[model samples]
Target: MRTCMTVRHGAERRTLMMTGAKLVLMRHGQSLGNEANLFTGWNDLDLSANGHEEARRAGRLMRHHGFLFDAAHSSMLKRTIHTLHHCLDELDQSWLPEYRSWRLNERHYGALQGLNKDDTIARYGREQVQQWRRSFDVTPPAVKPDSPHHPGNDPRYASIPRCDLPCAESLAMTMKRVLPYWQDMLLPALRQGQSLLVITHGTVMRALIGHLDGLSPEETQTLEIPTGTPLVYEIDKAGAVHRIGYLLPPT
Candidate 1:
């Protein structure tokens, strides 16, 4: 049985009921940076061995749940790209059309990229680092143009207009870019009854989930998304998010 519910989104009131179409959002598996507890941001790093196993397990879990995706989306970063590949391969959906965008990348950690989280906390107080990391609106210090981690120097982002590239971004800023992609690309497909899969970063997933779930800024900051776990959302005909849960049962 499906339960109908109502959710408030700012000025609008929306009713939600169960629909067959689903939106599956998964954070990419642990990257090398993740293993090292570093702020990776836009720095492209390959998945670690454990990360590869995690991706496989995520795929097996989704397959067990009988989830089939019509299309997939991911950031240009290697971790996400490889994770998506491993998942689709397990599901035998490797041929599905995939869309990549810089908008789906992790929140730019700016000057903090490649730095150890503990070291940063030692240098800057824990509260300040937390603000830069989890706060909705507080951006970290900008990465200098010459910094290797700067997005401007990355070939993957070269096609993007210079003015649009960000040196540093808050979770709120990440939403600004992510929401447009959701509205312009993913939303329409969902409205047309497409089951979609999105592989992205932890912070990116947080921002997107925050928007779709209508979470407050403070609540959004507290949300924790684990790597390689599939977060499933069922949307109805009216495009309201009716139900959300993990594809895999909680361990």
Candidate 2:
């Protein structure tokens, strides 16, 4: 096995390369909700101005490192979609096939959507809010059917079966939906040696990374994926992870 480490500005970074196949997973840039410190959940919001620059920077870094993809994937949400667009445009590969799926959407925060995070922490107590945010299976309080934040009431999900629409979701539940898309869509492409780029939300990326890296539920909770950072995974022909790390130096 070969690995390279570099130090710049007092920070150490690791770069890993695979012999044949690669997978890149990136969390979308900061959203307006993120800027407001609100629980966005399934609410569709655009990226903030800083978020757009972040996406562009991520793209430039990837391109400078010669990262290329045969296809790209993102959630149906506008934030992720815009991030993908900006990244691809920066890479000058906007022609790549782009796949969008609801399975890649952020974890539904139920009635917590649109609420300020600090206020929620104050109202529900910090420990409970943390559990709702990080626990694998501890679902938050479900949004009422009439609640504006309820995904079941969103017209964008109209084509999906009503039973499949989530009013609230735990990380584990989000993984259940994400894995099928990986298995049905991404895995086969990888088997054929196609490099893939996936732009998604933080929790969704965590679910996928945990699944790919064989992490336990507890370990997944401790994992933090920063916005706009690209995680690179090198997989061998046997479908095992050969190496994994961030594509750019940590900011």
Candidate 3:
């Protein structure tokens, strides 16, 4: 089902959308924290060696698909930004215009940013850790704006409206920021016949897919998008969502 469309409401004959604008969602590559199973959230770390390789692989995959996005969007964090850079490098279209916003950042793990996931689970209990990891609203305590871990003072946060910056965010809050960007910036491109690509963090990606697929808050956390993978959404004219899903590779 990853490669093929399953009819949702009607006998909407499915086919590859060749020319219409689309949304291509790509998660950032692995980081040192990811391999260590630490909570990164908005910690703004760089890609590991394997993460760099994953970015290159994504670029190759886009080239294989013959993909072209009119404009791109990414979070302010380095992993997401660098992932976009490497993806664009492989895409061979570095010149294509792009937009960066905080809306696409990974879910903010708050004070848990640098902590080990196993330790958190051990101390807080597995269920509580799971809630912090997946809950739509309850963001864990975060490093303060003055903390070394704070993402607010970073130049990347400059793009974000001040009211939204400096605070840790949950998947729900991410949606609040991202939706406006989509409706304000991205939707116009899609309507005007420009394919779009989104580079972002894990939980943010889930937030968007949740909105696109009509998943409930709890359901989005249950859905998994592998690290450094792509999720493509093909919408048609007349405001119809013809197809929306991930593209799985052969084993």
- CA lDDT of every candidate: 0.86, 0.85, 0.75
Q: What is the lDDT of candidate 3?
A: 0.75
- Ranking, TM-score, top scorer first: 2, 1, 3
Model 2: CA > 4 A from native: 1-12, 249-251
lDDT of each residue in 50-157, candidate 3, tens digit only: 999998898887777677777888987888889999999999989989788766777767778899999989999999988777888877876787776776667756
**Candidate 1 regions with alpha-carbon error over 4 angstroms:** 1-19, 249-251
What TM-score, to 2 decimals, does candidate 3 have? Answer: 0.87
Compute each candidate's TM-score over C-alphas: 0.91, 0.92, 0.87
Model 1 agreement with the true structure over 1-251: per-residue lDDT tens digits: 24243433334455455446888899999899999999999999999999999999888777755677889999999999999999998888999999999999999999999999999999999999999999999999999988778888888889999789899999999989889999999888987888999999998898888899889999888888889988778776678875456554323
Q: Top model by TM-score, which number? A: 2
Higher-lDDT candidate among 1 and 3?
1
Candidate 1 global CA lDDT score: 0.86
| Model 2 per-residue lDDT tens digits across residues 1-251 | 23232212115465444456678889999999999999997899999999999999889877777777889999999999999999999899999999999999999999888899999999999999999999999999999988878776778888999789889999999999889998999888887788889999989988988888888999887788888888877766677664467765434
Cα shift from native, residue 104, model 3 (Å)? 1.2
TM-score of 2: 0.92
Candidate 1, residue 135: how far the Cα is off, in Å: 1.2
Please give the range of 10 consecutive residues that has the lowest summed lDDT in model 3: 1-10
lDDT of 2: 0.85
